[model samples]
Target: MISDAPFASPDSEPTIRVQDKTLLGFRRSIDNIDAALIHILAERFRITKAVGEYKARTDLPPADPKREEEQITRLRQLAAESDLDPEFGEKFLRFVIDEVIRHHETARQSE
Candidate 1:
């Protein structure tokens, strides 16, 4: 079975166990970014939850392919402009969109 963790392994070592000051500083920054990402995702989900409910109430489809495509295109352009990989941006957005669709499906089922 696949783990739900953002970073998961059957066996892994944490840098803290080695006690390298440089690595420790880098990890601290990474940890802060990870926490921020989680908070941003939480807020995104909260809004998506409200959107899912509205869609269900209005008898709209769970997945909006047109809008999804538009977002992908927009984000890809933004990613390129920001010197980030457009492909990675597309993949990330697709993952989030998939999760949102899953939530929308569950909301529909519950309603």
Candidate 2:
């Protein structure tokens, strides 16, 4: 059974009722989704790393403002359609874009 209190004191041990299995089920689903997100991010970074290598070899700019803006626009629209916050989607995409650009710049310097 989950605690009636929404939050436990930081120093207190969490109270759980073993008879209440619903919370466990929900937590398992959350864990699975978290794992999937990690795998997806890993794959995305692998592809972006290859793109960075290609851009480095071809002397292309590490950062593309036009492309980034287009992606943010698209992501925001998609997030809105999915009932998510557009601003959050844009922020998340911007963070990833910044990291990718950093990797590209590092690759370029090493070339």
Candidate 3:
């Protein structure tokens, strides 16, 4: 019953697509965030890998309490500067730092 020309064609109701479009938007937004988080994790892993290599090459112990303390201090400063939850950020950094040290240990043992 509609004409072929643009002016006479049946116009679609936008709200009819709202639910599907919102779901797709949510999925895409989450995918973008997940990709960014993966990138950050990859960078962290690369740095940890480098540390592992260094420790392996130099026969250095990975657990340096003094160094870790220094790192904690630096991280706390960064959290404060960035207006993040300092305690939580420091704890998370410490956990990841310990994980890096464990990786270094594993690398050492594999050699």
Candidate 4:
């Protein structure tokens, strides 16, 4: 079960009710990591939003397939070096890239 307490502040550890101490510890770690990932993704989108606006203003195409492919290749190699699943990394990146393209398209339509 999850605690009622807010997990907003990193300094304040989130509480969870679990019978196993080890499992509770793991859960808390995962929660913190998940929160951090959300923050990271938010930042990424903020930058991408700016890029979308720039692309729209410059009348540039929303999706660049060559750049996307190059990024996938580079990230897959990095994922392999980090002992993470390259395919998963590529999928995650692709998802983000697709969303960015959608935002860019919207921006273009508004222009």
Candidate 5:
């Protein structure tokens, strides 16, 4: 079953527009953006899933904080180089990493 819009963040709410005769009205907008995010998130998971599968296949443990730290540092540096706010990017990436870890755990449990 479809769940609540996962894209609804504390800092932002998903905007739904009632611009047509659709029964969903604004729900369509919410679904559209939320659906797109799901696709993007799923594509990201494809890569991570491959990583997880390889790890499982090779019997490697999950949750590497050192690797995550290295990644945050590298991405933050890259973000600065790209003219983005390194601090902001770092914090955001860290949050995403945590989310990813949670997703990874859930996926592992399901398997």
Candidate 6:
């Protein structure tokens, strides 16, 4: 009988053992991807922070609706091409944009 546990027991079938290894491999890949995503997000925030400082120095507005709209559209198209959900892409971009705008506003206030 097949066990419902995540990992194969010592007496489990060879196929189940192989499946366990395969599952581990997939999880490792996912972990690596998650790590890369975090690094990329960190880099993006760093650049956005610099942009906020620059905008504050130059007396520019914190939020650019036109640019945000363009980004949303572009991201949606990219998501569709990548077989991802456009709405999810837009939501992610909006969340990041909102955080960036908040940072910019704080920078402006300090200027």
| Best-performing candidate as measured by TM-score | 2
* Per-residue lDDT of candidate 3, residues 1-111 (tens digit): 322333432585333333465767898999999999889989989988988888888899978899889988998899999999889988898888889888989999986
Q: Which residue runs of candidate 6 sit more than 4 Å off their true CA positions? A: 1-19
Residue 106, model 2, lDDT = 100
User: Candidate 4: misplaced stretches above 4 Å?
Assistant: 1-17
| Residue 94 displacement in candidate 6 (angstroms) | 0.5
Cα error, residue 105 of model 4, in Å, equals 0.3
lDDT of 1 by residue, 1-111 (tens): 233344536476422334556867998999999999999999999999999999889889999999999999999999999999999999999999999999999999888
Model 2, 1-111: lDDT tens digits are 256666666888876754457978988899999999999999999999999999999999999999888989999999999999999999888898899999999999999
What are the lDDT scores of the predictions, listed in order?
A: 0.89, 0.90, 0.82, 0.91, 0.75, 0.91
Better of 2 and 3 by TM-score: 2
Candidate RMSDs in order = 8.0, 4.4, 9.3, 8.7, 10.2, 5.1
Choose 1 or 4, whichever is better by lDDT. 4
> Candidate 3 at 81: error in angstroms?
2.4
lDDT of 5: 0.75
* Deviation (Å) of 8 in candidate 2: 8.9
- TM-score to native of every candidate shown: 0.80, 0.83, 0.66, 0.82, 0.54, 0.82
- List pairs with backbone clashes in candidate 1: none
Query: Which model is ahead, 4 or 5, in terms of TM-score?
Result: 4
Clash count of each predicted structure: 0, 1, 0, 0, 0, 0
Candidate 5 lDDT over residue span 1-111, tens digit each: 233453445676554334324747667799899999889878987888777766666656668989998998899889989999999998877877787777667666656
| Pairwise lDDT winner, candidates 2 and 5 | 2
Q: List the residue pairs that clash in candidate 3.
A: none
Residue 61's C-alpha lDDT in candidate 2?
93
- Taking the tens digit of each residue's C-alpha lDDT, what string does model 6 give over 1-111? 444466656795633433466777998999999999999999999999999999999999999999999999999999999999999999999999999999999999999
